[model samples]
Target: MNFLTKSYLAYSHGEKTVSPWVILKPLGWLGSVIVGTRRAFYDHGVYASEEPPLPVISVGNLTTGGTNKTPFVEFIAEQLSRWGLKPGIVSRGYGGTTSEPVVVLNGRGDRSVVGDEPLLLSSRLTDVPVAVSSDRMADVAALLDHDVDIAVADDAFQHRRMVRDVDIVLVDATCPFGNGTSLPNGILRELPGSLSRAHAVVISKSDQTSPEALRRLKERISHWVPQERIFYSRLADPLWERWDGERFVPVGKNMTAFSLTVFSAIGNPHSFRNTVLKSGAAILHEFEFKDHHHYDANDLQKIEDAARKSGGKAICCTEKDIFNLPRGYVPRVPLYVPRISALVEEPGRFWNVVVQALRPQIVVASNGYGEDAIGARLARKAAQRFPQAEVCAFPLVGSGIPYKKIGVRILPPLSKSPTGGIIKYHLRDLYQEIKAGLFRQISRQLSAWNQLRSSCRTVLCVGDAYLLCHTLWGQGKKALMVATAKTKFISGHWKLESFLYRKGCRKVWTRDEETAVELRQNGVAAVFEGNPIMDLSCD
Candidate 1:
């Protein structure tokens, strides 16, 4: 282990010295705060998320790698394909120096150009399209171009920019949350509470840890995720493939005849070595490299020399390491690659939940930009609170740009006037709407709502009494209203508006408590849950 790795492992094991503690702890806290704030910005719709038309299932971990995300991604893609759905894989080409997206299916995947993980995915998943890019949105678009039914994103739990239909978070069974601190001091990318954003949590490599430790880990995870949403997984079904001078072919697991020299550049090298030993092969020499380390000529020379010295028949490595090997350099000894498949407990139940999330819908109804923001925020809450629901937006006024910004689906285009529906301040604005064919737009929107209302279980109206009246009229059901236009601090709701609130809406959330109190006095179910408009500023 290097100095950095030693220090990291020390911190992960709860060993802290005064000097490093002072420096790294504060940095970790700052990182946690930055991530937390950024997550809040995305959650409140201050930051826009790109939503692709096809369903996306993201496999990610809260920590910095070592949670078997890649294998689990492979598992998901294969499962999706088995179910007759065309699945594509998207990854951040971390090791390679690629400036743009390289689609493996397009034959643009050079190992040094697109990185090892993407190449490994491309080679392993025969027909699956693998797109690598630093920009995940670009990768999703690439997958869309390929006419893929679903996109399986690798290492994207913290990537709030792209909205995911299903978010699967992986936790390492041995060291799950990594001492409970953020990077530099520990391995956590975000706080453990962030697991609440995940639709499901998979405790990976479950067989590697003690049963008691696994139980404790699951108990701790249960604080954020429900017990039913938590699943256990282990690396199983190993296959050994030996290079026959040109390509690797599957050789049965009876490797006891040959003494092997093993080397790997992966998240968990110890696990790989354990797997090698379990194959009944004798390991004469061992080498370990940092995760995603690119092998150069010197690294290859050292490994070959060590194999020669140890009198090993073959030099063994993991499947991922094969892509990172120096190009055009062939090893004199036979190169053996061991591939492992992830086996999840109760996989049927897990996939059932993932498929079910694609069903239910939540419609956010709004009339203005401010109302759109409020509705978008509410949509985000509904998404997080109820991961199964597909949250979307229906703007009564101008095109729902704010909803689109936050990755909320805009039901249908609505006509816009020069005044943007602010007719109360000027009659000239109403004339602009009339000229813009507001009546025709209203008729189309009502027809669209009638078509959509039956599919949606919940509708959130985020405007004035006019919007509430329209939403209730269209849906033929009481909607949860966020009364953004009228407040007691400015001008309280009129008696007619109060009557509409009482009769039409299920609940009204006001901008201020005084407005809610006044509306409550008039027999309206009004609530003051702080001002959502104040969340408009990302700062």
Candidate 2:
């Protein structure tokens, strides 16, 4: 079962359940194993490929959902069609029963076979084609056989085997990277660094993001990919498109202050909520589902009931969710679908770069991997330079476990001062003892630091020191707590210093210029190297 389903079930039972760590521990290990095996298989040429007839444009993201990929794909397909080129869309047909290539919209055949989005396109245009297949490569090949000029892969970022002419990565303006970790550990599909391979970075949901936040995000992305083309786009919500059985009817008016029964099966329901609110619609009720959730008859009944009880004027949903709903569901109520479009502030410069990459002169090769994982990629580079050295990984232990077990439980001192001492004095004494105890515990774990110091030339840390310390202990490294003033410290000052001392790390790196000055004033010899964390690129 998925994380939400398991969590909900546990809560419903009212039983003491395992923590997130307990659950993710096995999953994390499994993910690591899968990644490793996949890499090995690729290296051994287990899954080789053949080239397709035309250029393929993949619209995808590292995270599961929230990126406005569907609308962006539509935009690209429309642009291609306008240029007198036939573009065929190939999707994984997520949540659909069909596994084989199904021509949703042939541009020449009956439109009923096509889904809502495809049908919507078919009704509006007569030159574009849309199809779905679980095997994306096969679908693209089939489209090429039909004499299509170009093929667009919808949400195929993780499918690395199908070589593409251009890769467009979309980042949601909010929560771009979830806790900055892979699935089971966090929300990311691949490591954040994998974005470096993207040809262009499109910031979606820009309307909800502040100018300052957008600037900071850009600055962060600039560190890893200096030459990447970044573009800003927002979802236009004031424009409405309602499906009238066979075609979408555009309603030109600001839908502000209208009562809506908002329901969606998209990854980020909160994003939909904010979008509707921006359009001046009051959300009377919100029905959220798992990503790409296929709505059944019972689900429709629930929505109908909620809409009636709330006295909503209409039932609103995302374009994706509309395809999954029953054919006659919307006719029963005042259902109005909000059509989403990626409004690019600058299109000329963005398309120029995309066209440059699409030029026939640029030869592309399949890497046989979707995108390299950060740890694995780093290990490979490190191995290349030091052929004989062993590569070790120090990953942060999943936070889910600790958070669930502790449940806000603070660590306590092992002993108390004698009864004769003043209460304040006793408290101070207890604090010092506890600090010492923490140091001692850390020191014992790192006793083999000397061995690692002699054998290994360099120690690679997966992330920050708190999690790094555990990995260091696993690899027998003399981990010096690289304390920064910016690091969130929960305990008292004395405790923090003591903990650092026990970890065998006295060298600290300050993130900001002011932090270095503050640390020096406080008698800390912190070097202002700037924040390493900010250097991360989301592509």
Candidate 3:
């Protein structure tokens, strides 16, 4: 819908609520079925999920608009940056017409191309990168650079494909939960019980509630979640800073005494109205456009006419609305903006919830080109599933260009084939290996294996059984064996190498069921799973 109609707003607010809610319940149920089906697609891996190169913390709420999702996203970015990490934002730019990903705020153009939230984020957050695209799953990675430590996905709780490491769901403290229905009938986009998908829950606007009410709110959320996962926050210190074309001047008693014209295009205009009244500003006239409204010459002229009619001396608005205001068209009366910041009582605890989930890294090690491709594929999967853990690669042979392309940390001692994969030149390559000191290369390979052993919590050996033997050097270490090159029926030389598989790596995945049965008969813990390399190949 282009706008929230009066009937829907009345229904959402629980005024004249019943008959309309009953009429709309079937549609809400339909919304629930669709949402559930999508969630099931991701859960069962029917539709694939993609994770960014780094961890992602999503800021979203069940209710449609009033939760202040944008401001909370800013709060997360600031907090993540404070923890000595470079953070960026990926927003599904709702109002912009562009389909391609655009960097709206990085010391360049304004909000018109990237939508209001991104432009607002860029303006408020200096030196941070913000990318806007319709398909956040496919485009979020472009927003992040090699230096970005983590990413914040704005309004992405329902975006199942763009898998996030930390899902932080915000609840408006007044209602605590939704009006017990899904979209159209009420405010919730997903079912209320879906809050279980969140790793942490923040009850926003908590300051508005009394101490006893706040305690009850947390307890209520705990009914669906553990108490430790719940946190509280509010929009504190609402202040107006008057912009006189150049600098910001503080709004004071004298400023409020003058009759004022208010203009806002935020999701919750009532909150802005309350903040304006709190500033003691006398409202001469008020104009609220749709959320994220793009203003033009006509909108500006209407504001001028309204101010003239109401005899208001100045025009006031929220900081978000300033992004969409027409360029070089300052009204006759000055425009003042109300600035509100997200406040949390325990920021440290909230950050801890996010970081703890990202701990303990995964490492993939392989022997050759085929193995390296398989290792790179598994590393990306691990990175997506375990957002807190760093997934790295230690290539035993070859240049490891494939791992590098996927953003895997390619460990050194870069090796290459003498004839670049021409088996006809085997004699020349054998001579090259001898000339380069094959014994020294072996020693270095052993050292690299030790480094992998020290760095990773779990080791995945992709290609050769020699790596499995070398990687199992230390006790009390976890490892998985992928027999990518092995067949069910093999020569004596292959069977001799198969003995190393019995050295007790975790479950081994073989290329086919018969290979798994043979490995098991030979006293190795093996199972038939499809090859990882096939998933990586374009063919």
Could you say which candidate leads in TM-score? 1
Report lDDT per candidate.
0.80, 0.58, 0.72
Q: Candidate 2 overall Cα lDDT vs. reference?
A: 0.58
Q: What TM-score against the true fold does each predicted structure earn?
A: 0.70, 0.60, 0.67
Per residue, candidate 1 scores C-alpha lDDT tens digits across 222-323 of 998889989999988588898644467889777778789999888767778888888888999988888889888888888889999888778999988887
Clashes of each: 0, 5, 1
Give a tens-digit lDDT track for model 2, residues 407-504: 22111111222321122346776565455454554354344332232223244433333433443343332332334223433322354544432343
| Candidate 1: stretches off by over 4 Å | 1-4, 13-22, 106-108, 366-539
Q: What clash pairs does model 2 have?
A: 21-400, 21-401, 257-280, 480-505, 481-505
Report how far off residue 128 is in candidate 2 (Å).
1.5
Worst ten in a row by lDDT for model 3 = 448-457
TM-score rank order: 1, 3, 2
Candidates 2 and 3 compared: the better one by TM-score is 3
Q: In candidate 3, which residue pairs clash?
A: 358-388
Candidate 2, 3: how far from true, in Å? Answer: 10
